[model samples]
Target: MVVLPMKEGDFIKIEYDAFVKETDQLMDTTHEEVAKEHDLYNERATYGPMSVVVGSGTLIKGLEEALKDAEVGKEIEVEIPPKDAFGDRDPKLIEVFPMNRILSLPEFRKGDQYPAEGMEIRINNRTGVISRIFAGRVRVDFNNRWAGRTLVYKFKVTELIEDRDDRMRALISSVYPHSEEFSFEFGDEDAVDIILPDIVKLDTNWAMAKFKLISDLRKYMDLRTIRLIEVYMKREEEEEHDHGSEHSHEHDDKAPAEKGSEGEKKGEEPSENKEASTDGEEKADEKKE
Candidate 1:
């Protein structure tokens, strides 16, 4: 069978295992068992085939260029240099900052201590890693982690996406990475409903990214309506339980009023009996006169 080469703007699904060439360290993989075997399973990360638009800059330049003419179903290995992968490390990217300055940020101020080494933090919208901790100052490196390393990626193209819904999903991945687990529902009026994973829902940047993705998707696809599906866990369900409990408590508080009304009815019954007894006594007195 002859296979056509992947071209630009092609939506393709690929499973990959990426490594650092120098140390052969496993950087990332899309297989679950591989991650578990290597003790690299991160509960937060999704494991599966990743979708990408070829030549869309969604992937690193080297990988994108390598896949431009690659065949589907066949595994391919490519080595990407730092320049093509993450850019060469620059000494100017390293800087020192006072611990007090870092602690002044909202994300750090509420913490008990400065972040430990290798911890990534953002301050004033710039992301940096803590390289060293000192008495009153710390060293931060703003360079990308793979900036100076060559990346070796072994990947197999799984399939080419042709369906409009599938294509929209592939394009949405650029905005919301790690959303391979999302499912889709088609509706009338050319509408699509995207059911997102719980992890993506919890992302702090989801709100802002969602609006941007909506706009971008509207421009990219011909759909008339797009909706997000939110699946809540125990905590969100607990909120409903809380509301019900609150209503129950209010009913309990109003119980005394109900009892008061009953007490008034009890009091009126005795007064009626007393009035009947008095009328009977007056009739007897009139008969005797």
Candidate 2:
């Protein structure tokens, strides 16, 4: 049992499946094995532990209050209404941006969701571009993408590790799965130095994923930064001698050549040459033994 004190606004890591409607229908799943999924944010978006400011608008009022004094290892169900959640989608929320403006940008394509400068939006996975445009304001409705939809979240508090360094490691590992040898060191309590094996090549996007993983943590305590340290891979030495040679396979077929110049005449008789070849092969086998 975790008897640790859980004060208001204390950071906690939880694994939650966000679903829609009553019973339980999870729409997004967290990849963390311990506890790190969020119902409000979509998958293509940056994913990490959902940080709730205890009783802030970061989440619904019900959830902020529920986390207080919450016991670790206990599962809790939270239901948020449209008012508490994103609220009903007002018609004004969906206005059209300029058709030309939308087409000019690279990300404003079908299937991609891009929010206005100050607006928040979640992609619905339904691919579509601006089909209609009315005004110069480029009628873009800037509403919470999930507005008008009720959400249910089932969460289990895996831990509440207050140590900054420990939390940094946990956060980084969630995004990047490492199975091989590695080492870690801290930088003045604000960064984690990771020594990944040289043999493991990380793709560019994966590297950026790691960078963004740290970026989310920066929103919290400005606590630690994740850095890559050079780790020399240990190469196992190969032994030259074979310890077990109980059984051997050697076919005595081709005879050894006589030691003479390429143009030397065949001085020895054919019988003598055959006898010399046999003696040389016997000596070779003896050397091997």
Cα RMSD to native, each candidate? 6.4, 12.4
Estimate, for each residue in 1-289, the C-alpha lDDT of model 2 and write its tens digit.
6753455445567666667785455565454432233334443454445433333244465555556646788878877777777688877546555546664555656636653444332334322223244554444445555677788877767777677656555555545545225466676756666776553465555677556565655655464566766655444432212212212212222213333532245555666888999999999999999
How badly does each model clash, as a count of residue pairs? 0, 16
Overall local distance difference test of candidate 1? 0.83
lDDT of 1 by residue, 223-274 (tens): 6799898886678679999999999999999999999999999989999999
Q: Among these predicted structures, which one has the highest TM-score? A: 1
RMSD of 1: 6.4
Clash tally for model 1: 0
Minimum summed lDDT over a 10-residue window in model 1 is located at: 1-10
- lDDT of residue 98 for candidate 2: 53
Measured with C-alpha atoms, the lDDT of residue 28 in candidate 2 is: 57
